[model samples]
Target: MYRLHIANKNYSSWSLRPWVLMRQLDIPFEECLTPFESDSNWSSFRTFSPSGLVPCLEDGERVVWESLAIVEYLAERHAGIWPTDDEARAWARCAGSEMHAGFSPLRSLCPMNCGVRVRLHAIPDALAHNLARLDELWQQGLERFGGPFLAGETFTAVDAFFAPVAFRVQSFGLELGAPSIAYVERLLALPAMQQWCQAALDEPWREAGHEAEVQESGTVIEDLRRLS
Candidate 1:
């Protein structure tokens, strides 16, 4: 059996990728969650992952760190996680890699807080740029592949890669065009997403950093700032 070590389900976006992929592929794995606290020890994670990050996967003697790497590894074992068509597979890989490497502004401004809702009072220019690019990408993918998903009717690694973005968009009330809006709805409707959200709702852990600034209307953020 595979062992996957992850952080909090409510906040760890990176951890979600491999977890979602595994669940979607029906691959059985043992999950271990490590909380993020000042007093939390890092030695255990460091020993398992060279990068000292959550979302580390251990399959027997093989160890894989990084969410995308783990997803790719899992894809190797379960081929259908990627597209079957050669051209579509290439495009899906590109889209997934772009999501893995880019979107820093979105990550910083809107941390994945599944339990809290926040509205943006003012979006920073960098975040605006990031959102614009994301919108463009989503539009292109939808138009090209004719989705409910990035690569079309089926959910591929691309969808797994962008799932957190869908969560962030919903959490922060980000404005998406028609296609993107429809796409988000489809993502939210997924059984795996529902399961993930249910798990997040059941978790009892809370942190000050995860708290949102609540106004009379709702929680709001004044500016976008990258956490790291």
Candidate 2:
């Protein structure tokens, strides 16, 4: 069985990507969750991850780091990791790569914190640009492929890559057009996503840095996290 190294369910957006992918696809993997340390996780994560990051995959002797790499690794051995149609597959890969590399504003400003609901002070122009692009991209995929999912009728790696963004949308109450909004809601309602959300809300440990970042964007109007 594969062993997946991850971090706090509440704050580690990167960790969520591969985790959700594997879960939704029914790919079996043992989860190894390491809660974040106050100062730095570099030393701790370095034990298993070359990049000293969560979401590293350890499959027997083979190790995969980076969420995209992990996805590709799994794709090599598993079916349904991506769309079957050549066009859809190409578009899915491109969308996944864009998510892996771009969206700095959304990634930084609207960090994923599933356990809380925030009332943002304001959405900056940069974030607005990102949101507009997100809407456009989602609209394109949905229209082109005709789907409940981004690529097609099924959840694929592309949907997993954007799963954390769904959490961000929920946490910050970020608004989008009707289609995108419905898309976000659909992602959120997935059984896998709901499981992740419950775990996040149930987590008792709180990392100061992540908590502070949430404050940088908005007032946490409600904290749904476990108090004890």
Candidate 3:
């Protein structure tokens, strides 16, 4: 049996990675939702994960922390989690690793808030750099491997790694034209993605931590409320 511990469905980008991957792949696992208020409250996470972080995977006695590490572990067991072709697998792994490590500016400036539909006043240099790089990488994969998903027709960990970004793009209105835009739409339309988003919508526990994180950046309109 496998247990996956995740934080806020609305705001925990790292937590979304493996959760989406596992759910999309139909891998059976129990999910433990950890409510987070602030960094100080993170110590409570240690009960389920020694790392004191959400998205930790426990497979019986074996435990894994770090988002990418969990994905890699799952990939080792489920061959379908990664691309079958050697070159494509390498590309996918590289893309996943890159997403794990780089693009700090975009992540910081545009926090993943699935509930909101907001737009920035202006595109700052750092964020623009990250977005440009993201669009380039996404487009490259679509053209090179022939998409709908990043790396090919099938949804893999690479797509899961970027899943939060798709939500961010939808919510924040970050413009990544052509196939990148279409790709984001496709990701959002996935049943697994819709399930995650709706759970976030239904969740009533709004975290102060997330609100404070994105409050000063720009304007935000909670999409659900607007629709209502």
Candidate 4:
């Protein structure tokens, strides 16, 4: 069986990706929940994860770190982890990769806090730019591929990649075009997503950094930020 190590359900957005993907795809795996307090000897993430990041996957001797890498690995094992169509798969991969690499500003301005509700008093210029780009890209994908998801009728890796962004949109009350809004609702309504959100709400341990981020409303700096 695959072993998946993840951080707190309340804060670690990266951790959410593979967990959601595997769960949604009905891949059975053992969950290893590691809290973020690594200074303590109890923290297991430091020892096994090469990058010391959550969402590390262990399948026997092989190890996969990074959420996208884990998702890619899953795609090798499970058909339809991405889209089935060649062109749709390519578009899905492009969208997923873009989500993995870009959107630093949205990530900063509105971190995912499933358990808490936050409202951003002001939209930073950089953040606004990112949102606008996301809106355009999202609309284009929906128009081109036809969705309730980024790719098509079924949920693909692209949806998993953007799932946290859905959390951000809802958590911070960020505005989006009607299609984008409906898409976020569909993402949020997924069974896996709902399970994660409920788990996040049930978490007893809180990270100070994440808590502070959720409480703070205005803008964010590069050194600090967050989600799903």
- Candidate with best lDDT: 2
Residue 159 of candidate 2: its Cα lDDT?
A: 98
TM-score pick, better of 1 and 2: 2
lDDT of 1 by residue, 143-203 (tens): 8877767877788889999989888888889887888888898888888888887787677
Which candidate leads in TM-score? 2
Candidate 1 — number of clashing residue pairs?
A: 0
* Residue range 172-191, candidate 4, lDDT tens digits: 77888999999999999999
Off by over 4 Å in 1: 39-41, 212-228
Give the alpha carbon lDDT tens digit for every residue of 1-82 in model 2. Answer: 9999999999999999999999999999999999999999999999999999988999999889999999999999999999
lDDT of 1 at 217: 27
Please say which candidate is ahead in lDDT: 2 or 4: 2
Report the poorest 10 consecutive residues by lDDT, candidate 1: 219-228
Put the candidates in TM-score order, highest first: 2, 3, 4, 1
Provide the lDDT at 28 for model 3: 94
Model 1 RMSD in Å is 4.8
- What ranking emerges by lDDT with the best candidate at the front? 2, 3, 4, 1
Clashes of each: 0, 0, 0, 0
| Candidate 3: residue 169 lDDT (0-100) | 93
Clashing pairs in 2: none
